[model samples]
Target: MTLTNEFFQQLESLFPKAADSPWYVYAALVFQANDRMELISSTWRYVQSTTSKAEDQIVKARKMREALLKASVLVGFPKGINACTTLRKALLADSPEIESELDKDSSLRQHLSRSEKDARGMDFFSKIYAQHTDRVLQNMSVASGGDLSEFAINAVYGDLMAEESRLNAKETGLLEFLACYATGGSVWAQAKGHMYGSHNLGNGKAEIQGAVKICDTIEETLDIKVNRAPAENWSWLAKAEKW
Candidate 1:
């Protein structure tokens, strides 16, 4: 879909300007977008299927699980503690396939089982950002209306900012920033607030320049400009929190 004026205005309400991220961040944006879509899509299905009270809900839940699990591999997002205890527990409670697979993933967790250890192990951000990264996650969770919780936030970002990651925080933040921008909805604004507020992005004008470049990259990659027919407008992001 084209990025509409309404969307941009809503985004600027929170972010003020586009950010200039590193090259790897640009690349990560594409894959991250796909991962985020996988998350959004699967979440909807899980919600719909679970509340249906139909026998076939399991079938649908199973399919959604497949997609979400795959997305996790690509984006390195471990299902958060809340997701695990709530939806994952219910969905996998009786399903052998889901249980067996979730057991092996190592990313999904039923509680904040590894956060402190993960935090201690991390060496990704410099001393300052690393120390304060969890605070950033708290801010993001609050801005996302709790859709992105601390556990879920840590599962995904912990790896992204890990000491040995191929992608640096600057790169991670840029792609992350663009991924939020691509959402083109209220979530986009929230995403922008969290990302722009984070420390990984370039300072001042670099971010603005990066925003322009990110938009251009989106155009080139999608082979469609946000200025074109505006394609079917859709912006409501799944409340990808509980499930």
Candidate 2:
């Protein structure tokens, strides 16, 4: 279904301070509902018209191109290669000297003026990446997992193969789910379940390797909780009561 006014209204209410802001969610909604070619063309025209008004054409163009690339990815385009290449060509055409002049531009700063928003976006993106990558790895494992014995009881009970063809993350909502699943607990049982659900660990041989790699990544980069319970600061709140 097309994104109704209700959706935008709900989002606006949920994020009142971000009303009409140039955020991914807003752009994603448009991408989900609109035609990609028209959207990209319109966005290019808008950037051309508005960059002068924004007082820094080069910086504004870069941001618009970045947004276009993100939206393209959400709409099932190959963002890492094709969509990015297209966007970059568009940017260079619009501002042929953007790369050379970018360093000297005073008005076109890093847009850290909204550090809070930037931080929030980065945190969200990082968590999304961690979870989605984990899922892709897991699904590959299960589909490739050779023996049924490799999978734990839960995977068998849940029938993980039902999602055989559609395992990759195509939408933001799916990414959010993967992130939530990886948020806590480090016991062998939990790890097995996580690994099993991915479909990659279905084969006994791949299961162990998958688990190890996931664990290593989580330990190094993810703020994972192997032993801690997932909560909104129960420990710190308890400590604060002492003060």
Over 4 Å off in model 2, which ranges? 1-20, 23-35, 51-56, 68-74, 77-82, 89-94, 99-140, 144-243
Query: Can you tell me which runs of candidate 1 are displaced by over 4 Å?
Result: 1-28, 31-148, 160-164, 198-204, 220-243
Per-model tally of clashing residue pairs: 4, 15
The sequence of per-residue lDDT tens digits that candidate 1 reaches over residues 1-243 is: 333344333323333333321332232233244432332333333344334454334444443343333223233454422232344655454455545554565433343446643563244332325456577557757988865644444555443333222333444444444554544444555454435433344434445344445555544644633331233322222221111
Give the alpha-carbon lDDT of every model. Answer: 0.41, 0.35
Positional deviation of 163 in candidate 2, in angstroms? 29
Q: Write the per-residue lDDT of candidate 2 for residues 84-189, one digit (tens) a residue.
A: 4544565556655664554354422234334433344334333333445445435546776834322311232112211112221222222222222333343333
Best by TM-score: 1
Q: Estimate each model's TM-score.
A: 0.38, 0.31
Q: What is the lDDT of residue 57 in candidate 1?
A: 46
Candidate 1 local accuracy as lDDT? 0.41
